[model samples]
Target: MIDLARQQLAHDADPLVVKVGTRCLTLPDGTLDECQVESIAEQLVRIGAGTTRRVVLVSSGAVGAGIGLLKLPERPTDLPSLQAAAAVGQCHLMESYNRAFQEHGLLAAQVLLTADDINDRRRYLNFRNAIRALFEYGAIPIVNENDTVRTAELSRTVGDNDQLAAMVTNALRAPLLVILTDVDGLYDGDPADESSQVIGMVEAIDESTTGFAVVGTHKSGPVLSKGGMLSKLQAASIATHAGESVILANGRSPNILVDLMAGEPLGTLIPGQGGRLAERKRWIGSAAMPIGALTLDAGAVEAVAERGKSLLPIGIKAITGIFDKGDLVSLIDEAGVEIARGLTNYDSSDLGKIMGQPSEAIADILGRAPYSVAVHRNDLALVRDAEGS
Candidate 1:
């Protein structure tokens, strides 16, 4: 049984996002380690089984798994070659997950997303709704960044699964974000040197530990298997500020997920602010990529941040970049600080006409009111201070 305080903390926690790293899923030789993957899946099944808790897995190792299956010498550096490996590996990765989950009588659903999928408001809503439906059906959603289609040039790059998991946690409003890697947890110094100690229970991630070694081998001077420990910290910071907790642990440990859920001391824990973001508001704040930004006057900023009111067009003193209706955009104050992010119902063109206009005059100015609130409260996510900076 979990401690009452811990249980309440977990229950009232933000959404949980678990990112499975390549090193955790693959052997040192870069092969799919079925035993390890299966073990991790079983643990997850135990945590989500017969509970209201929802789990969103952000996984890597498609390329590595594929390379092993295809007998490739190493991870390809070229985009086309990398895409080819991802194409083959994504299938194998899903198959392994499906087989493992079946042993626990759980079904796994593959949900591949690219940066573009989350950048477009329509697609973002569609993706979110689909994943929600999958959970409702008692199936585990296996999420991966769509590597086969993603390009370096894409405007909406998640960069690594760590960042992706953070975004997913925000999207699902998960109470926790678990990052399972090869290492035990974040360390105070280089654990490889045997002089370092594991840093447990981080209230916040900060510069004191920013230079710690991430758990992975690099071909080119610490390129990081994908996003590395730095990225994980960055993601954790985002999730925690959104009122979600985060944990970084080793996936190889037996019953890891179950133990963590039960508040066992197994890894580093980053606590969350004990509050929940409203559903629609969470979606607006987290979903989609911000294509543009709205600069507000000081008064407007105060009203939105302190008064908890919807953003009106009158507050918008200036706009930057071109954006379509329903696009995710950033709300910046006079200092160019991102106060919030949300889905805009009106396009930049429409907004230009309505800027400084009253909400009541929206219909008269545009022939019809797209929405009463320029950026509805439900569609906004307030920014918090950076964690582990």
Candidate 2:
């Protein structure tokens, strides 16, 4: 069935973010597949043809290409060796993309970014401006993580191409984000079983949806990709919660991009929220990493998560990690699940003294009542509800 959301995206999605996994562009031997790269370039061009819509491509396979180029027996495990492979493979990957896009009379602009780049507000906006400039120049922006400098940034726990692509989609306010992988969207059962079928659309990401993410992976073994379906789903959750759509589809299929944009129901379609989040809130919820965490009592959790109230010291029961004033910290419920994140008004040391104390007792505990609230409602962003964790 054709969803109205997909149709709307086909007609109105101005700048699209498409993420292609490493496994889709590499062989079992970890070599760069030129033919696949060319096909991807061609499909990207076709998606923009006869329209003003532009595309930003998030591509993987640097380490794989490096392994093939250096003739390594297997994928590297150490940080130095992985970085070395990335340094070599980034050049080869760009060369292939440049040549492939040139065939269609389009310029491919390579943009390498690091986690710190996306984490800082100033650097993040600068990255967005650079992409906009490339659009004006009529060039397609091909983005990848700067693995050569900080391969740790690509670790699944910290972040990956999938998370990077979602961040780009939010930063650009792109209406759609299409994640292309090896498997055929998300499945109801094990993908290896013939009886399992692809789920057509997902309105919201919940525990049930996340349960499906544990089916492991297809096509890409551990040597090729560290990100599995869970990472992709988490990425999708990030985008969708920000009022942007996501399509998880198989890149190996012929003309997959073309078919998906045409509202052909090619993959699992996760629809967007009703309204977009404010820029500052978006950053707090998705971009910024927390330095510390505060565990709130049940009453505090209800007040903050359900009533849109500020976090008070009276509700805070436990604190973890060392952080200072204005630093980002996570708010955890009694169950240890993160309910929200925001900038704290006081440093960890100050907070430790006043936790569980009423607002009136702040001055007595800290010697100065500069502020009453632990986290202002204006600064806090509710995450658990949107992510449905």
> After superposition, which runs of candidate 2 have C-alpha atoms over 4 Å from their true positions?
1-4, 151-158, 219-222
Task: Evaluate model 1: give its TM-score.
Answer: 0.81
State the lDDT of candidate 1 residue by residue for 152-215, as single tens digits. Answer: 7766687778878877887777777889987788887655657767777787666654556443
| Residue-level lDDT for 161 in candidate 2 | 92
Candidate 1, which ten residues in sequence have the lowest lDDT sum?
A: 215-224
All models, RMSD in angstroms: 4.2, 2.1
lDDT of 2 by residue, 1-389 (tens): 66566777777778999999998899878899999999999999998999999899999999889999999988888889998999999999999999999998999999998877876678888999999999999999999988888756432233889998998888898989999998889998789889989998888998899888776455434486667898999999888888888999999999999888887878898888768888888888877678799999999999999999999999999999998898889999988999999999999999999999999999987889999999999999888866686
Best by TM-score: 2
Q: What C-alpha lDDT values do all the predictions have?
A: 0.78, 0.88
Task: Provide the TM-score for each candidate, comma-separated.
Answer: 0.81, 0.94
